[model samples]
Target: MQSVSEEIKIRPIFNTQGVCVINSVLYTGYECTLFGTNSQNEIVEQLELESEIVKIFPVYDKVLISTITGKVYVYNPAERNNKLQCVFTNSVIKSIDLDGEAIVLGTADGSVILSDVQGYGETFNKKMDGMITLVKFISLSSIKRRYNSKNKLVAVGDAMGTVTLFNTTGEVVYREKNCHSGQIMFIGELGNKILSCGMDALLIEHSLESEMTIRNISENIDETIGACSLVGDRLFMCSKDLVITLSADLKIVAKKRLNIPDINGFDVFGECCVITTDEHDIVLASVVQDTLVVDKVLIGDNDEITDLLVMENMVVVGTNSRYIRTICKSDIERQNENGLIRNKAFSGELVKSNNEECVLSMCGSNKVFYTGSKDGIISKFEVVTGNIRDSVRAVKSVSAEAPITAMCLYQDLLITGTEYGIINGWKIGDTLELVFTASASSSEITGIVVNNKKIHCTSKTKEIIVVNLNGGMDSSISGHKKGMWSISEHCQMLLTGSSDKTARLWKGDINSTLQHNTSVVKTLLTERAITATSDGVLRVWNTTTYKELGAIRITEIKDERIWAIKRYAGTEYIVSAGPSIVIIKDSSWEVEKMKEQMQKEEYIAKQHAIIFMKKGEYVSAAVEYYKLNLERDLKDALKRITGEMDISPLMSVVLLDSYKFVKRVSKWARSPYLFTITQRILQTAIENRIEISAKEADDLSKTLLRTAELFNAAY
Candidate 1:
């Protein structure tokens, strides 16, 4: 019997920060802690900063931390707090990079300033237009010295879409105006070439040869390129719409469209690239045959991932909303190689509460599930099966004086809002630990969400209260004139439904998306704003217009009163909590699932074929392998049955994975029949002028010489 591991591959990293791997140590800054970890990303050294850290840069043996208040702190294990130095600036520093012995700072004041680490004084400074977004250090060691012996180069990108390259001696080497139509987000260098990508949706390459020449390497790709990195000779760029890899010659090697958007950052190591999405999705993609194919995807329990560092065997992720987490790269690869069975939507099997009271609120990640009931009890359940009843294991229970109204997961913390207007936060691991409890509202606590290191909670008092996690001066945000029921957030917009018979959309920035007045009784947000009313009609509103697009009423249900609305991305289903947990049937979501099912079937068939091949059923396995477009497996099956079957039928199997087939045949150089198979395949490849690597050519030469020697010895 074959055993399959049912463990979820990727785990959650609570609040994270920008991560980088230095000499096998994962360095990252999250919230107030700047830490270093081992290869498995286990924290070995931790230091708490005075203020919240924004960015982390590794300069030589020390780690430099840039704070939100424009203060820079240099941390060294050998130096104590008093012995370590700090640099203070007036304006906010958005980005930092190391150039030679000087630390380059990109400030919000639109200036690129260099602070010498040795002297702890400003060595050079130059003012630019708009806020400086990114600072990158590029070494010109490979370039000829005739360009003035300046081996150190610094590239600064600003919000106005300009990229300027400066020499170590404060001399301008290259400048490009409007290199990107929008803010430049990324700047990476490979040899003498520089790659820049930004909101303009353009990827431009600049040559640092004799004269600086700029070229648009990518077309006006419609999606904003959020992050980019250079790996070997390939440049990996990711955006909301797609992930693309381009060669050094400006030709695209691979391109993959994404179903989910907003890739916060990515790091490339060897053949695979680790991707972190804004919604806390970590994905692994492999480069094969000029195509970037998604090998594995792990949905985090909670916490928005901010950045990641890819290592040879592991990945260290930093999050803005939680602490740092380390995941094994081998686990991701193993799950990808072996078919991974994804979690399906909850089949409406009720897990009755201990007191038989109605479960009011439910929120969970893939790892665990939490439910709150009218009994004033909060229960933690481990996910076990597909159905709700079987999937839940009542592990721990906590009680509140009042009935629980709302619940949310933030990293390891589980926050609960109760009717008594109290907010409780619990940190869960081997056991549940109550972190803090606060009297947040005078009336019933309605909705809650953690954002910007603050807890935003709405209540029957008709106001939203914002409290910092670290405990400080709390503030109340005024907008809703009546009691609020539910709150949902997407991107920068927060949607709330109030008892005043109105649904309000709060924009994080000046540019708001909600245009029309929505009078829906309740507004729940996801990628779209979904609303419900007393009229028993649930409507979907366009997020841009905030206008009704469609309406649906559940079949056989008369009341249609919805207590809560939730979006589940794993199954692409929108569920409503009311008389019954109703799954609103969506055609688009169903279509994607249908496609996935079809592909899953094909994958399962391929796995069965491999199993059959191991059992020595060649003919039947070959047919199944052919259906999966696994040409190499089909060829191997043919090789085993060479004398038993005609070569014509074996050759008829159309080769789809030619690269894998050639590479496989290259290994069977010692076998007489397999050697002939290898020679014939290479001959056909040469005749068809198929692309083959230099390693494959060398393997073919050795196989042919060995075959010739074997033939001479036989004569």
Candidate 2:
């Protein structure tokens, strides 16, 4: 419910995996963990391949990845305790098959080779018309009326729809054409039936008993069947939009939509589906749920982060040569590293660490840190040990499509700042739980805080906004008022010191008016009227009725001026930090009676604007104060006070009506999209006024667009 503070970091996972989801299972050969999804999904905890993976095979606890170079990288989930890694295969291990001690390899140029794990290798090259696309083992019932392992046949589907079947003994059994109308996509077996589906747009049901192709499926399908598998009675096929779960007869039982873009890899485990998107985001969700939740987002920084450290009594922060930084915990920062400086802030002599890459970070606790760099490498930093560890964990998050700016720790959560000026947060752990976050219109967040289930953030626009932990914004308080020299808050009262030589009491919400000077509030003629309460008195106020009020008489100086006052405990003391300093005699009084008088405005409204014309009284009350250098001259302050003495003080009500209208427009953005038209009035005003800079106008345009997005999302 709390708003996400301005500074947080995040990555887009939609670009990595193309339609096929990535499944982040343990991998071998990369020397790093990979977070990949099953099909076209992005893989979580998967390693980014130094080379492109052309093919993959998931066998029980091991996943095999093959590249065009003929080498195979094997990842054993059991051996590494399900950690992602890369295992090298000396030879370009192309297509592989497990046949007891012998391994079959399909060469790049239409040749079949044989090899053994014990170093024996042989070239089983045979004359072929075309290159092999896929190899599968199948069994057909024979005269013996029994199907066993040795009797099983291997089916090789070529790029040109040619189907060649070979017995386990390497003898050609059956060769056929017209088997598929077009190029065959793949062929798999279910029971005694041979299922073939591909660009021909059909699932051919081949019968073992008839030794012929049976039914050609051409029903209830929108797109071409992509990756498919079967376990027991269920047949699963992935289409462009949805994953269809079918029974043995090809009857649709359950269908789930694959809505998000760029799914790289995907896998089904029991009732849940684990998927990775091209965006390097990992999600594990139930088939029944319409919206899937991201389990974890791998932190992938394509830069080289050199130095890292945990700060004392604060969150872990790291630095890189590119001036990129992050705050993280020690343990998480140690997941992947290439060895560098200590992961902590320097003491005494400050030296910038020489890191080569732009740093992206995720923090654990207040002292553990993790940083990712531009070279697709990650480093982990441990503050307590003062050491950097090599890749212990793999995070595949990316930011190439967009730049990530701010990142932080909200309690135990992760907050990230985006280039779009959006703030997003998620709970940090093995599971990424969604936390509340927000944006400051088109403003970027520079600081954030969380407490009492409320998130408070400060933005580049100089606004402080409060929102719920779930991102419901409560209030946005504007920091500065136009034309006011300085405005600040102390205790609960809003104080405004203006160039008009007046210090006015503002309601905490910038409402209400002070009563003492009905028309002319705290304006003074000497150009010096800023009030504060410290010790026992605040000078330059009506000391007649306020509690612990005070006045000062600077006999040595020429003009009476009050710059600042500080209230510590219950006493008021004044300090002159500006150009003209003044020493004064104590003139103080209690403010209780003054507070009582402020509650009743009619009693102080005895000034009649119609009948009695009082010249000096009204004009003197609204006096303007300009701070003149005491060291040079008191002539200006002195001359102005005497000259304005005979003038009648006039009161002007503060202009808040325009701000009120803007506030209404902001509220309108939340419920309707009509704020765009409502803002036409603001455009007219800008056209009448001299716009600041072209850049400022562009920024305002973006702010308006962001406001539109915010409002649109609300509905």
Candidate 3:
């Protein structure tokens, strides 16, 4: 299986500064719960985030956060021993900003929410025209002729192309009439001009006085721009492909586009652009010969950088692993700067890749790429000339015994779905170790996609889970059951078309069997289907209306039930593969057996364990003895047992695990089998000089002596 970091893909850090931070909900990379390289360029206090930090805004002292599951958290970097103080509210925060407890949040319903984050104060909610994408205070404005100081002016951008400016003291000042063509990525105020950037490469310069959209920049750019910032007329805007700078009137000053395969987000600090990549590597860049030159790299231990922050000269990074990174901007910026690239761009390092699983999914640019594999490995490969680069480890292999089924890339983050019920994310970097691993559902994640709100995923249990991703890497599970599979936008809608012959759809996120409780919204039978096979074909069906979209004749069967159905380009040609046949479909689908056969074996093992537990107290003790160290020694031990007995490896694990949970065991005076085994273990321990409790060892020795005497008597 592929376990090398090079095999997996990672996104890039689009921005950075004097102070930067990364927030994650599910994992921490460098063995620290919360590790931050302080301004002193050393890892300081390690702390855990309250839930999962999806977005973090570094304020004066503390940081404001929006969680994946739609919660908000305010963390204070008081001292090394400061406790993580947080609060929860009912409203789901889509985006956030920290203004001295004046928490400004972009809500899900296209509202800009202002909360007094300092003390126990009420959160103020107000609606906007469209779903809010970003909310920011007009910190500093143009060479101010005269602008309100105390009465803060806030800029709110939304899903649509509109960006409105609201004053904290009172009414609207000026709204950009034609802000952007589509969704506005971000908006900010630079001097007197209003800066707005969006999905398309459009960044408009408008006058605060006239409210008129002036110079529309993106003139020569050829990629999607996600964010924009400015330092007195020198405009900084990020593109889907690179970071570009413009003059006051929208003239292209300089462009920094590192041919990164994937990018998450980016920040700018004092002549440096801290770009976080998909592999969790923070590339610190500086201006060198008219280009944004990369001078240093702070590699995150295989963490998917969900949100990047640069606050008050302090750096913070959050991961999907439920941890916040307070790293020093200098820690990453401390590297040798290379002049213009001459012959070889730094040494072309070649190393042998040690990944076990083969490739399963891949994404990235023409120069670099990242791949996710069966062995849980996330690796990165460089495109040297026209050949693929060697495998360099990025994210460590995961716990998924089955192959990684799906990979979705956004910015610098890679979201992976496996056959097991796990959706893990990893940032791309030099080392391949898991920085954050989250469980979307234990339903065997098969597919993952990112929309405006959350990262939508589908699992083997045929459930769609939508988790708000902006809340940092550790964002919570909000948008619960609405995904592409649900077929409908309603969270109540559900469907069952795969193996369970009679396709059933539900109205809630619950399993189909529990639909009776939530009301079965709709149901359709795959009536003409044959017995379930691994490679069987499947056709599309409607759950809400209970209608099969295509004809049943085309959804045919070969040797086995189809495990997966894939469509290419348009819906015309498709591919459905399973145990044997990879049936290319014209307009068809299939049903197949559940892939988790090991779960059944594990259940059987647990049953056997319970039986053994009831045998006697001594026998029960065996459970804990073996299971306590199961992950360490027991895994290989169980592997040996399965190899010897031809038993299911899953069963062996469950049986051994029973030993770990064995609280008590009993030895009846009439049970000879127990006495024999106990005596043999005691004798072995004594011979190997391993310690055994005095009283227990004595009892075992006495039992053995008595048995020996009995044998002598019988002879």
Instruction: Indicate which candidate wins on lDDT.
Output: 1
Estimate the TM-score of every prediction.
0.41, 0.36, 0.40
Query: lDDT per model, in order?
Result: 0.61, 0.41, 0.45
Model 3 misses residue 290 by how many Å? Answer: 5.7
Candidate 1 global lDDT: 0.61
Model 3 per-residue lDDT at 689: 57
lDDT of 3 by residue, 22-69 (tens): 331111222212445432223444455455444445555455555556
Please estimate how well model 2 matches the true structure, expressed as its whole-model Cα lDDT. 0.41
Candidate 3 has an lDDT of 0.45
Error of 3 at 315 (Å): 28
lDDT, residue 415, model 2: 57
lDDT tens readout by residue for model 1, 1-715: 1111122212222134355545655555546666554433234556777787776666677776677777776677555353346856465667777656778888878988877766468768899988998888877565326456555678889899998888777788788877678888788686566777777667667666544445554463555677777767777777764877777786777777765436777765455565666654545566776566776544422332222323333333323222223334343333222364221211111133353354566666654666676777777655454331223346777776578877777787888888888888888787767788888888887778877667888888777787666433388877766787767677757777766667777776332333224334455677667766655456666567665555665322454355544442332233332322333533433444676798999889888888878988776677677667676786687566544443433333434566665655566556565665556655655666666778877877887788769867876
* Candidate 1 least-lDDT 10 residues: 341-350
RMSD of each: 27.1, 28.1, 21.4
Residue 620 CA displacement from its true place in model 2, Å = 65
Candidate 2 residue-wise lDDT, 1-715, digit = tens: 1111111112112222211222333222222223332221112334565665555555434566665455566655446455434443543333455555555555345655444533355534343455565566564465114434444566666556667666555656566655766555556677656777654556776554467654544455565554455545566665544566667776668776644323334555555555543323334545433233333332222122222233442232233333322223332223223342211111111111223445533334434444434432233343443344221222323332223344445566665554445566666565445465566446534334454455554444434556666667688655333223223343344444332333455344554322221111112112123242212122454322222243433212233222323221123222221111122222222344455565454233323321122443322222221011121122222222343243222111101244443443344333224454435434544554533456655655666777778876886
